[model samples]
Target chain A: MHALATLIALSLASPAAPLDWHPDLSSAEAAAEESGRAMLIVFR
Target chain B: MVRPTTLLSLVASRFECVRVTDMAGVDLDRHRFDFDLTSCILLQRADGHRYHTFGGRTWEGAESHLSVPALVRVLVRTLEEHEKAELPPRGRSGPGRTVEALPPLARRIEAGRRPACIHCHSVHDWQVEAAKEAKRWRPQDGWVFPDPREFGFSVDPIEQERVVSVEARVEGLQVGDRILAIEGTPVLTFGDIVLALDRSGDGPSVRMRLLPVSGGPSASPVERVVSTSRGWREPDPLLYSWRAMKWNLDPSPGFGGPQLTARELGGLGLAPGTFAFRVQYLVDGGARAETGRSAARAGLRVGDVVLSLDGRSDFRSVDHVHAWFRLTRRAGETVILEVLREGERRRIDLPVVGLGR
Candidate 1:
């Protein structure tokens, strides 16, 4: 539990990792996040 | 029409029977002779009308006439003068004196300066030979014309396609993910995952193994797994390496890179001014066989904001990130990650696994 808590704390404090992932967002969400246009992420 | 007097003056200026004239009102017809002869002349009427003619048989009428034989003699003389013109004037031989140092008259006539005919009654063959020589020596490549709109940049966004690979967090997936129970089935290297998803039948889910990110004893064990319908999305066109290797200034041919804006970042659930991160999570079953290694297994999840890599502060593009991984890390190596999760920054240690193949 301490390790988990420490890990969570460290992640929040630094919030920078080489291996972090982002959830695939909806087109609407992507549009809201970016300007001009949204990125198309298709899984095949 | 060329005045007889003007034509005679032209003939006196040099030794040529036919002289080219300026036409005022109409086009003149012309023809060639069997002995490889060509001609051009301008004709004008008393009424201010004029005609220009070219490429015809030698003039035969009383109008400026020179027999072929007499024309050759004058041509020779003109060629001699041309040869004299080529040398420095001080070194030229006296008039009528043949100089061995100078080029032959025939060669000069072939060089293209002497006129074909005289303006007056004199028939000058020198000019005609010169013109023929000039016509024969055209450059090989031909003339190059310039394009009017040579510097325009136009883009057609509809034709864009890019190949990209996504490394995601999969807790239940491990190495040796089978295709219909075939062990050692290569997935990542061949890019079969995308193909499988693209050609999958009307099924609710697909199964695959995920390797552990860390090679520690606590890593998770590989297990058979199924992704629920809510967990899957239609695969986009595959981003091939050949296409994704470079970015086109014009978006017409391939997919354009993400142009992130402040607003867009916020909409993707990222904080304004915060850098975005893409993470990969590995799930491994083999590690479970070894005690304590199973706990080290981890996978990247959505919504994680990455801040740095190997202590580097800058956040590069996704492609740069992949290159960094391929260059610096090896399979089974542990990586320290700092991410923003649940509105808080957290640090996690994950192990690297062999890229799915």
Candidate 2:
């Protein structure tokens, strides 16, 4: 019983999946120019 | 029987300094204490002393009805009287002969720890999850985290891609550039581009299959090879030691000074409503290396008041100076410097250094 409870707790503690962005170059370029600062587009 | 009366009398005497008024329409007769947004008063007796509570959900003390100043005065007086009563006569010989003292107990017992910024202040039981989420949302707030791209190259849908082809349009590509293949393998989404780039063997050039930005059969399927520069691998906006790039212009005479004093680098003394001096970093150096030592060697010393740079009258923050330097000056070039140091006025000539990454 303790093991089962511990397993449930561990499952709850797990982090959510990372957020993803849809690739769109035009929008990306527009955002970079709008900010008037350098933009970094990172892919995981 | 008399002890309760004496304690009540003593507490009432302490509260004499504060203005007290009876609160009507409150169940003071039943619960002996009633509190509202503005004030609270206790009429009940516990252990012979009437307890008065106040200040929102967190009652400061049983005697919370008293104002802060009144409470402090009463506490100090009580401590002083207690000490006097406990002390022995001057001739007495023992620990009590000198003076009786209260052990070190906090006069104000905070109910809970205070909140503090992780970057600037220390706090207890800081919420790791909340802090981490905040940092992830605004990673720039953290000193250790580097910005995503050094050259400010951020992409929409920020993901890696294998270039199917490289083409430069005079007007620039207007979207619809697709990857046909990576190293001759069929490519699909942007994810394939990153995977292919990773798997591509160590080489100076990578060959990629390209599709035309315009949706039509290419006159001919093109295989494009792009060359990567070794120097390009070096981080742009190079990091320089902050101690090497200090310059100041004095605004005392308000920009039209015939002479400027040059003093040793003194601490930044900013006053309210005063114009600020600019601290420029060497374009080659990153923000961290942009401090006094790098400044001193770069012809800037303590106590040099900045007046103007690059036709800008306001050079207040370190960032302002850095932006001006990058936009106006080039490496190995001399820039005009008007500074006030050591009570003497002089115009010193200084050379610009390349930024380090």
Candidate 3:
């Protein structure tokens, strides 16, 4: 319950504007592999 | 982060930046996390081998967080390492599909909200809750993001991967030496150290392989086993990762800081050398009956200044108080806490619980 509540609070706390974040994880991984780059996972 | 703004395009072009949509379900078991913080960053390869993990801040202000310059430096180094074919795959397996996917709070939530990524912190909470259910969790378990500094060595956070110093008894390692492998695992960056220690978990000694930072295969590598003292994996109390233990009052015990100054300690009848933590924030774990068992059972107040535990006050720092309590004491054990509530020093016995209990 604490986990869910904190999640809800985080969703509500997000700023009005959405940043240009990757839409999905798999696509990001695919992009990284094709580009020969690393994956940066930002948890906020 | 401001400095990273100018380099944002550079990072975007060089790496895949992802904010995983839903990390609560399957992803919970996929990636292993150490600290429970509001914000963290993990760097890994496309093959699922991790590079480095950083970014837990105290949030006092902009100064409290990591600098953009530091972040950029690390990015530049990681990119270079990748181009040179130095980064390796580590701890890689499936995408957690076969792992236990249900979070602790899953049954309490509406079905529609079950898979949602409410908060990144939920990942840590669920992992802790799950560990507790299986009776494998420990109080010192949250020190998952251990720092080399805690071990008396400082590694260049970026490409050099060189040791800055040997502060403690890191046998056979010294300044100017670079780490090659830890516990037989090939490691290239500080992120690798984080991953290694996270996987190490409550071990008695830390074994590391070292090489000359002067960069020549001509020199043979040396192996060193750094026998640790108690609380070896515990990050220093002042670190952003340590804040993962901050003050909370619900589904789990929350730890917070803004340690008491000498004046505050004096006000609480402590001496100039006293170490105490002033709780400034409250983490409401989740919903619980107001009258039932909960944080209220602990009888600790937000402003209460903790002086010692079980008559032990020889702790190293304010944060060390909590680390010592959690690391040394076992679950269901009673710790006699000497605290000052509104200038009145009283002893309170706190029943200890493991990390997420």
User: How big is the positional error of residue A31 in model 1, measured in Å on the Cα after superposition?
Assistant: 50
Q: Which candidate is the best by DockQ?
A: 3
What's the lDDT for residue B271 in model 1?
60
Best by lDDT: 3
TM-score of each: 0.21, 0.25, 0.65
**In order, what DockQ does each candidate have?**
0.01, 0.01, 0.28
Q: Of 1 and 2, which scores higher on TM-score?
A: 2
Off by over 4 Å in 3: A1-21, A33-37, B1-8, B25-38, B52-65, B84-100, B109-116, B136-143, B149-152, B156-160, B184-188, B201-207, B213-321, B330-357
Candidate 1 residues A1-44, lDDT tens each? 12322232223223222211124222222332332111111111
Candidate 3, after superposition: displacement of residue B296 in Å? Answer: 8.9
Q: Report fnat for all candidates as fractions from 0 to 1.
A: 0.00, 0.00, 0.57
- The alpha-carbon lDDT assigned to residue B108 of candidate 1 equals 48
Residues B1-357 of candidate 3 have per-residue lDDT tens digits of 533344544554456777653554335534554435554556778776665555533323222324444556666766776677754443345676422354456554645555434565555666666676777765555655556666666665344357777766555566787777777655665556656766665765778887865547576787777655665665554443244443221223343457778887777667798778766644454342331133347776677777776787776565555544444555556667777787688776665554334
